[model samples]
Target: MGIIDFFVNLLKDPRGFIAGWIVALGPIWVYTPLFLIVFVETGLVFFPFLPGDSLLFAAGVFSADGGGLNLWATLIVFYLAAVLGNTSNYWIARLFGSRIIDSGKVKALTPERMAKLDHFFERYGGLTIVITRFMPFFRTFAPFIAGTGHMNFAKFTFFNVIGGVTWVSLFVLVGYFFGGVPFVQEHFEVIVLGIVAVSVAPAFIGVIKAAMNGRKGKGGE
Candidate 1:
């Protein structure tokens, strides 16, 4: 398939994508692309749309018994990718976040989204890093915002690790334990979409709330 078609397939059905890679790249090398996907999704502020939660769940499904991937290895690769990804994003923002924000180059970081993140930071403090780990777009942006706001590096690291470990472990283990069910096997695509919806729901809700609050503030003024 062409590159665009390949990614379209990957986004549409991550399980099939992982299965294809497992066969094509063998059990060992498949982890490379998986690593890169998770890394880029979390690391690059511009690429938040990449599938992170579904990808991990799909990887977990493959890592199950007789599924051709080593459970431990899959976990380790994802853990490292997630942690290192956030660290790089953090530093990138620390050094250049202001310029990036001012340039209006990243369409992903909309004013509504930024307001939501600011609310998260103000309410959760360092724990915002951990909380946003389960959130898709926010996960990618939280570290960058933290860096731009001059949050303590040590605090960010602590929460980043916690969030990474918790987020990866929860989704992967859920798939590992339940992905083999007959219903899941038959309706894997639907299930993947469900995962995406559930994962994105919180961020969606937060954005709506932020918009409403913005309107209320304007009314008050």
Candidate 2:
């Protein structure tokens, strides 16, 4: 598996993964790895489940130390990654999204799912792209969808910048500010799990609501 895949899988046992990494990479890996992780996470839809929030948080925590990289530096690297990643995904959608969708290679984005996502992007437009940056599968698909729908580039960039900067700053700052606390250090995995769970909540709610409506329609029929 690739490096991102390794990190993503390690999230399944986050506590161990985080500890191992702080020791293994020391502080130098922080610079390039930060850029690469965010880039791939946003750029490649297949790697959506990779850890963005937690990774940033971890980087922030590292930056707080004397040997670690600078917090602002980390933010800059990842922010660029986020924007460029979506930009790449946007082009990918422009060129091949429909062809792939039409070919039925991707079963998750069925006609119904595609319609639902379109409705979501229309309702929220570029904000949908930015906000879903924190989300898992949705984050990966949002830019791709925007490409397919032919969302205006200027608008996409606006929200994309806001979302990328804000999302990176929020998590990184939080990790920098509070990462050293005994509770956080000890329960890091729990926190990561909580974040992941909350991140997926909207999608979960959507699925539940859809299921309920389906049941109601069947009953009425």
RMSD in Å for all candidates = 1.6, 2.6
lDDT string, candidate 2, 52-147, tens digits: 877777777766876256777877888899889888888888889888778876555556556667877878776787777777777777888888
Model 2: worst 10 consecutive residues (lDDT sum): 13-22
**Structural similarity to truth (TM-score) of each candidate:** 0.95, 0.87
Worst 10 residues of 1 by lDDT: 3-12
lDDT of 2 at 16: 54
Model 1, position 28: C-alpha lDDT score: 92
Which parts of model 2 are misplaced by more than 4 Å? 1-8, 13-29, 107-112
Clashing pairs in 2: none
What is the lDDT of every predicted structure here? 0.90, 0.76
Candidate 1 residue 36 Cα shift, in angstroms, is 0.3
- Mind giving the per-residue lDDT tens digits that candidate 1 earns over 44-162? 99888888999999999998999989899999999999999999999999999999999999999998788778888888899999998888899999999998974889999999999
What global local distance difference test value does model 2 have? 0.76
Residue 182 displacement in candidate 2 (angstroms): 1.2
Record all residue pairs in model 1 with backbone atoms less than 3 Å apart, i.e. clashing: none
